[model samples]
Target: MIVVNLDVMMAKRKISLTELADRVGLTPANLSIFKTGKARAVRFSTLERICRELDCQPSDLLEYRPDEVPQNV
Candidate 1:
């Protein structure tokens, strides 16, 4: 399973959702969905913007947990 580590990275960078959203040119609501790991899919462009604003790599934001089961499964 894939896990979104957005909140962790944001906390490390000391950035708020509203602030990050503005910097990444996305609405806070939309970013919130992604941050909460409720997003079914994400665009690479969005990931690039997020990584750029957070000053992190894509691996820092996403993680794989093979032990976890998918909710829908």
Candidate 2:
């Protein structure tokens, strides 16, 4: 499973959702969706904009955690 650490980074940066959204040229609603991990997909351009605004790396925002459920049944 992939988890988004956007809130964490936002906290670290002490930036508000509205502020980040404006900086990244995204709407607050859209950014909120991504922040809450409800987004099914994200474009690389969007990711790049976010990283540029947050001054963070992609790895810092995304984390891969293996699901505990067994794949082979």
Candidate 3:
């Protein structure tokens, strides 16, 4: 399973959801969905924007846990 570590990075960076959303050119609601790991899919452009604003790598935002099961499954 894939886990989104967006909240962790946001905390580490000490940035608010509103601030990050503005910086990444996304609406707070949309970003929130992604941040909460409720997003079914994400675009590379969106990921690039997030990583750029957060000053982190893609690996830092996403993690794989093989033992976890998908909610829909």
lDDT of 2 by residue, 1-73 (tens): 6788999999999999999999999999999988887788899999999999999999999988796432222
Instruction: List ranges where model 2 is wrong by over 4 Å.
Output: 68-73
Write one digit per residue (lDDT tens) for candidate 1, span 1-73. 8889999999999999999999999999999988888888899999999999999999999998898885623
Clashing residue pairs, candidate 2?
A: none
Full-model lDDT for every candidate: 0.93, 0.91, 0.93
For every candidate in turn, the CA RMSD to the true structure comes to 1.3, 4.1, 1.2
Candidate 3: clashing pairs of residues: none
TM-score of each: 0.92, 0.90, 0.93
What root-mean-square deviation over C-alphas does model 2 reach? Answer: 4.1
Provide the lDDT at 63 for model 3: 93
Model 1 clash pairs? none
- The TM-score measured for candidate 2 stands at 0.90
What ranges in model 1 sit over 4 Å off?
none
